[model samples]
Target: MADTAFEAQGESVEEVFRGATQALLESMANPVTVSGGWERAIERTDVDPSTLLFDWLSEVVYWKDAAGVVFREAPLTLTREGDVWLLRAGLIGAPVDQQTQELHADVKGVTKHRYELKQTGGSWKVIVVLDV
Candidate 1:
């Protein structure tokens, strides 16, 4: 793949995933933590690598909606098993009460618009547009 796909110049998929997780961590108001859910999920099924990005991100939104927790980090793993596309990841963060926080309308999914991880310099950055 072209190096231009990464946000942190010259980064690989692993690096991009790491950077995106870190960026998500920094954007949160509180510290979010991840459990072993990611590993367990990945081990359980088959999935497409191309679809993993959106599924992984969407899962984050699902957690926020279900638990009201904006994760400080999203540790995602994409692997293929058979013909299925599996997305396994864990989220870390504190839960925000529905009454106290001004919650925006929940995001339905991620958009394909500018959805890329690029490498700039010696690091990676992710540019993602959410589709609500």
Candidate 2:
């Protein structure tokens, strides 16, 4: 197996995270085929932006595995409180139906290998490598 990586750039941190999640989700399953029925609320915190993205993505992966569901969208808010990065997300999706939905490569986990999160020129940029 080889490392699979994706990059997302946005004007805001929240947008970048959303884009990153979209990339990850699309790599695992077809978002369009998964009904936006199931829902999960997640809250995570970290001291650093990079770590926050890593942990939050890992948590998303955990939910996907634990619930045996595919997600279509994650409406989230990423904010800072006293130097801590807080991510609160409402993840929406449905149980994967093999007969109706298409599943792609399975994601093993989010890895720190070549993980990056940075802001340059008023835009946020991220590069995440997934263990697939």
Candidate 3:
């Protein structure tokens, strides 16, 4: 599989995170074919946004690697307290089945190289590179 990289931007933090999540799934499979058969809640806390984004994507990759589950939809909420940032995500998708869905690239992990998250002109933008 080839390396897949994409950038996502949104007016709010939640929207950007959601866009990133969708981009990840789309890289692996066609979004139209994947259905929401199961739901998983993921929670992570980090001292900074960059680490939070890395860890969040890493966890999502772990799910695909360990459980054969591919997440298609993510509704996320982010909150900050002091220096710690909390992320709560409700992810919905189904386990991989070759007969049911066509899988594309196998995302090995999320890379920190060139990874960035920032706000520009009142919108949040995130750049992510996935190892496939």
Candidate 4:
């Protein structure tokens, strides 16, 4: 098993979330090889950023585990409705083919251990740990 840890920071919540998705993609395989042959729509709402991040990443892991899909690009939009934050995302990737794409580590799921999401200064920063 392998453990992958990464930190992503951005000026906005959307950028930070996209960075996290990129980190997840990199952990699984080369992003360049992952073409968009399939699509998944992810919608999540949470009261806080940390929980939203965890749910968002867990959704990605769900696709990987259930459908063998690894996302290379995630174009998302975030909105705030009262006290809740809503995320609507379009995920792009193809089904993992062992012979065509080089496999790195199989990420089982996102771990709550060492997971952090915070706003420092004017930027949003997130740290994620993935269990492989």
Candidate 5:
């Protein structure tokens, strides 16, 4: 059985992702949010998973910047293999760039920005981001 503790923590993470996704989506309709999200991401350093999150979020922001499309909430999956955890999520918006874009980091490549989530033992984990 899945641990109740993970369920609680996962809910919090989901909320954050949902809010962030919504913020980006809202930006498509309202220019202020788009600019704000972009400005916030720009002000920070491109640090591994941190930057990965920004880039993932930025992709949505970029759409608003380029075209103006809002993405719906996507189901997230978490998986693990040995010591590596894999996170999978379907891209849920009509994005301008269907083509995979190389992240400005050690991330090998974007899996269509899709992810898979999984758990093992008593710990829940996923490939939140990659370092290629």
Candidate 6:
């Protein structure tokens, strides 16, 4: 199986999520060249933080393919309401430009293999594997 393992960490969940977003964006291209002219807002909910993150990253991949654009920025917030955790993000993107961007392998999807999210010592960390 062609896959890549990714790790991200931060002092808070929101910061950790942002790190994950950066890893995701970096996996596809050199983000410095993306420009981010297009914006797509996304909302995802799940019963737990780990699942919420899994679903959110999946949505990011969805937008990348569905909109024919590569993401340059992902600004988000994670909140809890009742029994569910909700995540909202503004995905800033730009169309795939070969001349101006440094492209990499196409990401197939996020995989459950060795997928993990953990918080310890007041800091949060996550590990995800992507099918590339």
**What TM-score against the true fold does each predicted structure earn?**
0.54, 0.93, 0.89, 0.92, 0.35, 0.92
Residues 1-132, candidate 5: write the lDDT tens digits. Answer: 111111111343344444444444432333222212121222222223323444555454444445433344434543345644334554444433333321121223223232434345554333332222
lDDT of each: 0.50, 0.87, 0.84, 0.85, 0.36, 0.86
Listed per candidate, the RMSD to the true structure in angstroms reads: 7.2, 1.3, 1.8, 1.6, 14.3, 1.4
Whose TM-score is higher: candidate 1's or candidate 2's?
Answer: 2
Clashing pairs in 6: none
Tens digits of per-residue lDDT, candidate 4, 1-132, equal: 258899999999888988998888888888777778999888989999788988988888788878887766888898889999999998888899877776677888899887888889999999898988
Candidate 1 global lDDT: 0.50
Per-residue lDDT for 33-86 in model 1, tens only?
322222112222334343455456556666666765655455666555578745
lDDT tens digits, residue span 70-112, model 2: 8888888999899998999988988878888888877899987
Tens digit per residue, CA lDDT, model 6, 1-132: 577778999998888889998898888887888886899888888888898888888888888898888878888998888988889889998998999888876788988888888989999999888989
* Preferred candidate (TM-score higher): 2 or 4: 2
Off by over 4 Å in 5: 1-14, 30-48, 65-68, 78-87, 93-132
Top candidate by lDDT:
2
How do all the candidates rank in terms of TM-score, highest first?
A: 2, 6, 4, 3, 1, 5
Question: Higher-lDDT candidate among 3 and 5?
Answer: 3
Candidate 3 stretches greater than 4 Å from native: none
lDDT of 2 at 114: 74
lDDT accuracy of residue 67 in candidate 2 = 88
